[model samples]
Target: MTENTVESVRRALDLLRELNRQRVSSVRHLHHATGLPKPTIVRMLDTFAALGYVVNDRRQGGYQVTSLVRSLSAGFHGDPLVVEAARPWAIAFTRKFQWPVAVAVLDRDAVAVRFSTIPDSPVSPFHVTINNRLKLMSRALGRAYIAFCPPNERNLLLRMLAMSDDPEDEAARDRDAALTLLAMVRRAGFADRSATVEPKSSSTIAVPVMLGRKVLATVGVTYFTSAIPKAEAIARYVPLLKEMAKNIQTSVVLLEQGGAPNDGAH
Candidate 1:
């Protein structure tokens, strides 16, 4: 491709990615998210709409992607970009430490595990499937994300959690306590849960994966509480977990910059 053609393709992909992230986004939102000029974004969105890859919603005052975009990943695996980026490192960490690790991202009011090494971990005693969802206010993964995410996003997530009907989300209703917990997580630079959300014998330490000032996801390591004390676990495993998280963040950023293969390349 010519130089201008390559640049155009990159910009188009960036716009498409921003749309995918937001689901429904206005030109202003696209401009902000992709750092593209408003006129350029409008033109690209119009082109995408004409090509049936996106739909312009006059009523909603935004643009939404169409199923045509799914064709781009028709043969792809289920994991998202962050999961793909973190998979090798997560598995390696588990292999080295004999402790299962999970990579999770915020999904609405809860955190969703996008990648996990538990099932395949060499040392995992139980043959258990990964839990896809965890409460935002009570789980280490969720708290790590909430604590590290930008203030506007953290506030929005808190509001969503507070509106949840689940009794466990009552912590979201206690603004002071919730804030205090998040403050601690931020100060400590990691979140810990001991027999709170998991089995009595299990505990977890989670840290956020950051891209710039924004948290892209959380990486966590889980172990049997009886096997390792909380202080020892924090001291021994937290650095490794944070390192893996940082590496994953770097991989994701490079992938976003077109340094790696597309999600479906696998």
Candidate 2:
């Protein structure tokens, strides 16, 4: 170990990260998520509570980060410009369709959900997925972002994926098949989750947000597989999602220019 390294600090940060992944986390959930021992979690949570960065409310089902944690984000943007522009449109899409929508931005080897409308959606497939990370090959949001990104960036991401140990990303090892799949996504104008992955009862359809040739982020909606045929869902939802992406793109430009969204979008 390095002389300057502190194992306790690293573990505490890891625990904090797991806590931030969902709205609230039970000790069991924290144990499963971080693989940290129960005693360690208790110690850390108690320490965090003492420090005013966390609260343990039995009525809330578990421990949750307190607003004081915001102090840690003094200079952290958390994809603010993109997420700020996307929030209303994503919520609007969920309101109209009654299905949950999520916005993801590339985060190194995978895509991370920055915003989700599961709370706004009456028919949310999952109870919570905020801050979830999805693999680049088998997830609709990840595929959408990777498929539409510029070639140089795509190649670099593919190389990185090829080296990943995550089973969902194994397709990258078969370079031809992976590229072919991405080509199909490009041709179809959207991406769908692999049928073989978990939660086979539901699916996601995703489209990229692009400015010129560069993709800024990906957006997707999750729906029950039995509620509608895939083709019909694609026909109906893809257009709206594409339009949402366009509105988000425009909003990004306006936000960057010190203006608000034009108020013309749903």
Candidate 3:
């Protein structure tokens, strides 16, 4: 496609994202937010709706997002490196902890979960989904990645997220919390997420997958709050979590060495 065609598609997608942020928005409001012509905005919305990517409210004269975006997400989640690098940790972590485990990567300001394994848990509820982006500030794994990311890159990620057209103050707070957690991780060598799901029954522990000083991704274990008591969660798993972090680091180093010559270390 021509450059103009690509740019048009991008702008249309941006319009859709903006509509999603407003909960619902009218064509005139979209024209105001995006500076696109009202007729063009209406046409794009109609096209998007026909494709099941968006839905309109006749009463409100507004539109909202649908599940079609997730169909696109399925392709991105299938990337080889993301799959190859994360799947082993997912399997190994679940086997060891008897809890849910996930491997995730930072996608701009979002956390993209490539895969997750849910353990049988009678006590705690499972809420996370594969291919879903977690709230960057609220999730332990996302925070761990942000905490260990190199200073410049981390700062850039934060700034870009802050200035995004779909800016989220909650996401910024999460980044701050992640920074705080990173500092604690540096000193203590592991990160924990307690009472994240229910006041009584869910928690998590996360570790960064580092390549030298850079953070490549994160691995985490989650449990129903009741399945593992708070004290036991830390006592039994923290050390093993650290071990997994070390192994991930070593693996990164090996992968770097095995890459085509002159590919700079991550």
Candidate 4:
């Protein structure tokens, strides 16, 4: 990448970090907070605005962070509110189902694991890292997300799949299958089980985290088929996973609707 690109990324991150600390700021306030040049700060604000991460108040000449930024960092930001919101529900689901539970959000071509209560299991071969890609169409969590996304986004993803490469023509062959998986997940109110993405594992049951109709993330419990039958896993986990997802969605909505609590800081 070019120096400008690198600098741009740094500047953008600095701006966001500052906003997270202060809650709200104007271009001048950002400059003071970041110690970046005035022109640079303005450019960063403009870019953030364009991406819908920052909302500008023309009248006050200030800017405030928007939920879209949290959405963009849904898997990685580790926002206290998000963690506080998801952990209790995730833990409860894990405890009740007696299985490992994880929450993930889409990040470009991959799905990033945000949090997990998955205990080390010798029987299960799959391993997931926080904030890392895990294929776009493979896992139950990934498919659950795609299933709940808007038609425009879903179609765009499908179009990309049609044009993409797959050594086994896996993408092409599974196009319909992927769509089917999504449909069933929606119809059943949750993803039953999947091992198609990470072979050797018995299955993963997933539910989508919807924010105002947008699929913000997926939360699921994974278990080894050898340890438990796929049918049994699904039968045991889907309802609980669905409940946790609803709780998480409610928290996200609350965070968005609530005013800035850290007002003076930012």
lDDT of each: 0.81, 0.89, 0.67, 0.68
Tens digits of per-residue lDDT for model 2, 54-115: 99999978998888988987676757588878999999988889988999999898999988
TM-score ranking of the models: 2, 1, 4, 3
Task: Identify the superior model by TM-score, candidate 2 or candidate 3.
Answer: 2
lDDT computed for candidate 4: 0.68
Determine the C-alpha RMSD for candidate 3 after optimal superposition of all C-alphas.
11.1
Q: What would the per-residue lDDT of candidate 4 be over residues 1-266, giving only the tens digit for each residue? A: 55546776877897786764433467777788789998988888888889888888867447877878768666765444555678778777656656677778777655677776653222323433455555556677777777788978877776766666853225534667767766766788776434444456457777888877788778878777778787776777776677788888777766777745445644
Local lDDT at 108 for model 4: 67
Each prediction's TM-score against the native?
0.66, 0.72, 0.57, 0.59
- Which pairs of residues have clashing backbones in candidate 3? 137-174, 201-225, 202-225
lDDT of 1 by residue, 104-223 (tens): 988888888877776556555432334468777777888898888998998888888888888768789988888888998899989976244556677789999998888888999888
TM-score of candidate 3 versus the correct structure, residues matched by position: 0.57
Comparing 2 and 4 on lDDT, the stronger one: 2
How far out, in Å, is residue 200 in model 2? 0.6
Per-residue error (Å), model 2, residue 226: 1.6
Report residue 236 deviation for candidate 1 (angstroms).
0.4
* Lowest-sum lDDT 10-residue window in model 4: 119-128
Cα-lDDT of candidate 1: 0.81
